[model samples]
Target: MFSEQFNVRFYETDALAHVSNTVVAGWFESGREPIFKLFSPNLDLRNWPLILASYKIDFHLQIFYGKPVEVRTYVSRIGNSSFETYQEIWQQNQKVASGNTTLVRFDFSSNKAVPIEAEIKSQLQEHFYPQQESAK
Candidate 1:
């Protein structure tokens, strides 16, 4: 798994003083940066190869501002033309939220999904979710 820590900014909080639900999505995407670099070295939007198919988030606890949060990311599934990312947000050593996102390799010109390259698939395998940890 790959992870990153982020210091919560004041503006990210909601009226209730917890990090806004909408902000979690952005944080999850930030955790995916390492994986994104595998597909797009410079992260150029013009030639972006992946497209989001769907995503789901579950909150386990509230995430307050003024503290740092860590996002852990793992590749849960990899298919011929798509892959799924599983991520979790932790604060104060407790899991606050988790999410999963499905993204497909696409051919923008044709507006169709395409098979991922063999080398890329091999690289993705290196980031698979550990079976033992999944039990937690």
Candidate 2:
């Protein structure tokens, strides 16, 4: 699992003083940065290889500013051209939300989804969900 800590910034809060629902998506994406680097450490900014295909988020608790939020991300499923990322957020030791995103590997030049490379797949396999590891 890849995990990161984030602070609930004042700007991210709304009139009700809760972190905006939209903000959790950014936090989740932030948690994916390290994992993305594992796949493309030398990726060119002008031509990106991965793009988010879809995502779903379920908010279980509200988040407030001035405290740390913990996000944990993991590889859930891998296919020919796409993989699923499962992520969860926690604040004060309680689960704030959980979500998943589907990312597709693409050939920047072709501008279409492409199969995941063998080497990158191998690296992603190392971070598979624990249940997935047990299944194998």
Candidate 3:
């Protein structure tokens, strides 16, 4: 798993004095930076295009200003041209939010989605999370 920390600044708080909904989304996106680095140390957007297809987040608790938030990310799944990222936000050792994002590898020149490269796939495999079996 990859982790990053962020402090809840006053500007990130909503009128209710808690971190805003949209700000939480930004935190989840930030969680992907390290995972992206695994594929290309210096990701060149023009050459290797990636597009976010969708994301889902469940808020478990409120995150307040001045508190430190930790975001943990992992490669949850991989496909030919798309990959899934799972992330959790922890504040004071408690899980406050968790989510997943789907990103598709794209070819800007061809104006279409492209298959994930072999090298990238190999690196991503190292970070895949173990799948959990569903309860009957």
Among these predictions, the greatest lDDT belongs to: 1
User: Which pairs clash (backbone N, Cα, C closer than 3 Å) in model 2?
Assistant: none
Task: Give the poorly placed runs of model 2, Cα more than 4 Å off.
Answer: none
Q: Write the per-residue lDDT of candidate 1 for residues 1-136, one digit (tens) a residue.
A: 8999999999999899899999999999999999999999999999999999999999999999999999999998999999999999999999999999999999999999999999999998888889734754
lDDT of 1 at 41: 95
Predict model 3's lDDT versus the native.
Answer: 0.86
Candidate 2 lDDT, tens digit per residue, 12-127? 99999899999999999999997788667875677678899999999998998999999999899999999998999999999999998999998978878899988888888888
Q: Residue-wise lDDT of candidate 3 within 39-85, one digit each (tens)? A: 55798665667889999999999998888999988888889999998
Q: Please give the CA lDDT of all the candidate structures.
A: 0.94, 0.90, 0.86
Q: Which 10 successive residues of model 3 have the least lDDT summed? A: 127-136
lDDT of 3 at 117: 89
Candidate 3 displacement at residue 34 in angstroms: 1.5
Report how far residue 70 has shifted in candidate 1, in Å.
Answer: 0.5
How well does candidate 3 match the true structure in TM-score terms?
Answer: 0.90
How are the candidates ranked when ordered by lDDT, highest leading? 1, 2, 3
Among these predicted structures, which one has the highest TM-score?
1
What shift in Å separates residue 134 of candidate 1 from its native position after superposition? 8.5
- Stretches off by above 4 angstroms in model 1 are 132-136
Worst 10 residues of 2 by lDDT: 38-47
Question: What is residue 101's positional error in candidate 2, in angstroms?
Answer: 0.3
